[model samples]
Target: MSLSSFKREFARHYNDTPANYIKTKRLEKAAELLLISDERIKDIAFNCGYNDLANFTKSFRERYSCTPSDFRER
Candidate 1:
């Protein structure tokens, strides 16, 4: 199958583009780590595949309405 065909099928099955799916998974994992561990927010962001803490925090806030550290504190 062509790349387009595969991507379309994936979207139809998952209701999300691959990039969105990946970002969602990464954020979910980061939230899980925050609840389960005492690791620093930046470290958790890095472990969740983010290289820059600001971008990670931005994305986290967009998804959850709070920064990673604030999310963890609550």
Candidate 2:
């Protein structure tokens, strides 16, 4: 099947929007990277498809209520 069909099927199965599905996956991966790697914040942002560090920081803070560094520290 096509990507769109697969996304639709997955969303139906999970009862979530495709965008939300992708965001959840990205956040999970970001948490893993933060806990397991010493990589730079900017590198993690870019690797997670965020081109702007500020935007990435905003999103990260919104989700975790803290900056990436602070999250890592805890």
Candidate 3:
């Protein structure tokens, strides 16, 4: 089967596309890490599969309505 077929089956099984699911899960993990540790935001972004700090910050803000540092501060 092709990658598209797998993606379709994955969506049918999980009710979310793989890309969205991955992004959601990564942010969730980042949130958890922020709450549980004293790691820097850049490190957390790297751990969450985000290599670019700016992109990670933008994505995090979009998902959580706050930057990683702000979320950690709360």
Candidate 4:
């Protein structure tokens, strides 16, 4: 299938775009790690498939309405 066609079908079936689904899953894992592990935020971000710490922080904040550190504290 064409790229656009595949994207549309994937979204229809999953209720989210492919990229967004992956991103949300990554952030969810990061949140779980933050609460359960003693790892640094950077390490958690990396383990969750984010190579850039700032980008990870921004995405996490957007999803949880708080930074990773703040999320851990609360």
User: Residue 58 of candidate 3: its Cα lDDT?
Assistant: 92
Which lDDT value does model 3 have at 6? Answer: 96
Alpha carbon lDDT at 68, candidate 3: 89
Error of 3 at 14 (Å): 1.4
lDDT of 3 by residue, 1-74 (tens): 99999999999999999999999999999999999999888899999999999999999999999998999999
Candidate 4 similarity to native, TM-score: 0.93
Model 2 has a clash total of: 0
Candidate 2 per-residue lDDT, tens place, 1-74, comes to: 99999888988899987887777788768877998999998899889988898988888888889999898899
Better of 1 and 2 by lDDT: 1
Which TM-score value belongs to model 2?
Answer: 0.78
Clashing pairs in 1: none
For model 3, state the Cα shift of residue 52 in Å.
Answer: 0.3
Per-model C-alpha lDDT, please?
Answer: 0.94, 0.86, 0.95, 0.96
| Higher-scoring candidate on TM-score, 2 or 3 | 3
Clashing pairs in 3: none
Comparison by TM-score, 1 against 3, better one: 1
Candidate with maximal TM-score: 1
Off by over 4 Å in 2: 1-10
**Model 4: per-residue Cα lDDT over 1-74, one tens digit each:** 99999999999999999999999999999999999999999999999999999999999999999999999999
Off by over 4 Å in 3: none
